[model samples]
Target: MSNKLSIVVVEPDRERAILIVDSLRAAGDFDVSVISEVTGLARHVSSRDPDVVLVDLTSPSRDILEELTLASGPLDRPVAMFVDRSDDSLTKAAIEAGVSAYVVDGLRADRIKPIMDAAIARFHMFHRMRLELETTKRALEERKVIDRAKGLLMKARGLDEEAAYALLRKTAMDQGRKVVDVAEALVTAAGLLS
Candidate 1:
């Protein structure tokens, strides 16, 4: 389990996703979770915290590419792009969109298997340091979330820090989640209701 690699695959095509999954599983000890859209990708990424993300596409769309790029942080992992976009402008956009490894046309998965494996291995090598960075980022984001939740709770229920935290902790314990998770949930809920 400790030696296993987790990867999030954002490929819209189910068959291609399976091919990548099978190849990766055959090549290394990888736990692959495949998804189609960017929505909820961050949650999967933040929770699963995969070592790398393999995003396969025939071309680069401004919105989707940008979303995938922004996902790198919460994922705290490098992105491997298996693209068919051969246009120079789009290629440039991909690089600026946070693609760590961008492979253009004429590069199929089999031909690039070794490179992908190496990239994934390198990602794991830096996983610890990346985890530290993500921990710091998460802590900072948690502070902001908790503060917002606390403010809402205080305004709505007149509670102090200790009481607000106690509520959050109890909610987390009951739900078998982290206090930060509860805080985030609360904040999200507040945002929706307000």
Candidate 2:
């Protein structure tokens, strides 16, 4: 467990996973751990919070892509893929899914060593700045969404500002979603139906 940096490899092949771990450890840059599935990776991300995620992907899955996209987007976590398949569509989807670096098959110590360092460093730098920006933007956006939803609630349901806010809060609580999420849904539905 290196305090400096960590990378979780999503390789299901026990042999390849071990090899990747050895190679990465040999690089002497990263503390590498392997997770066999997306669920394991999610838990690893939440608990370990690795500086960079190196997913050894053989194919694509929509749920994984969405999770990766959301994890990388507002959270600004950096994820890269050690991909076996080079299909154009898969590459495009991986990029879209927030995989920062898509390394092809030739993952030698010398070739991928520097890349691993650079990716981890850049991911930390960019992730920090992106997190700050996203926090500010989220706050501002939350206010706007809540205000819009409140306005709609007052106009359509004849409620005061406090009552409108309460309605939004109640909906969020009942649905087990964030207040901002509820507000956004209200705004979208209003736009569509009203």
Candidate 3:
């Protein structure tokens, strides 16, 4: 991937958006787009396919936060929201909505780069955790399928667990498929037979 990051600044105020864009430009060479209107925000942000999103709101409402949740897609990219002030409930809502970074009373030109960096890093950390979780869940599901297949073989062919697994492995090797795939097929066939 290129080093240049495509950023989308969602600021209703034109002047503030310009300042944020200028700060980003000063930090590094970045592809930045500004969304001044909050209407159809999801479409605007998605169209840009930005690497990161920076939202500046004077005082965010629940409705706006919901809109931002749809627009930011916290899992897809890092989103840093800057607000003048906030309460516990609003802060909780923002984090729950998948905002990577929620800054309160800290939107200065000098602080922009560091905040952006932190948001990206935090997002990556969460992304890695999510991927690892998905991998673990998939492995567990595959193990269950394999065990079911083994049980079916043990009952039908009077084979031991090891022998049943060997059969599955052999079938997978012969077919140029994964052991899990063969096991899944066996399990599906057994289910259909029942």
Find the candidate with the highest TM-score and give its number.
3
Cα lDDT for residue 80, candidate 2: 38
- Model 1 over residues 1-194: C-alpha lDDT tens digits? 56455567666667655766676677766677777665665455545655555653333532354344443455244343544444455444434443333333334455445536544443343445657999999899988988888788888898987898888889899999988888888889988998
TM-score of each: 0.35, 0.37, 0.49
TM-score (C-alpha, index-matched) for candidate 3: 0.49
Give the alpha carbon lDDT tens digit for every residue of 1-194 in model 3: 87566677666767655766776676677787878776777667756766556653233522453344343454543333543233455445435434433322233434444546543443345456778999999999999999999999999999999999999999999999999999998888888989
Error of 3 at 22 (Å): 26
Q: List the residue pairs that clash in candidate 3.
A: none
Better of 1 and 2 by lDDT: 2
Model 3 spans with C-alpha error above 4 angstroms: 1-109
lDDT of the candidates, in the order given: 0.60, 0.61, 0.63
Which candidate has the highest lDDT of all?
3
lDDT of 2 at 94: 42
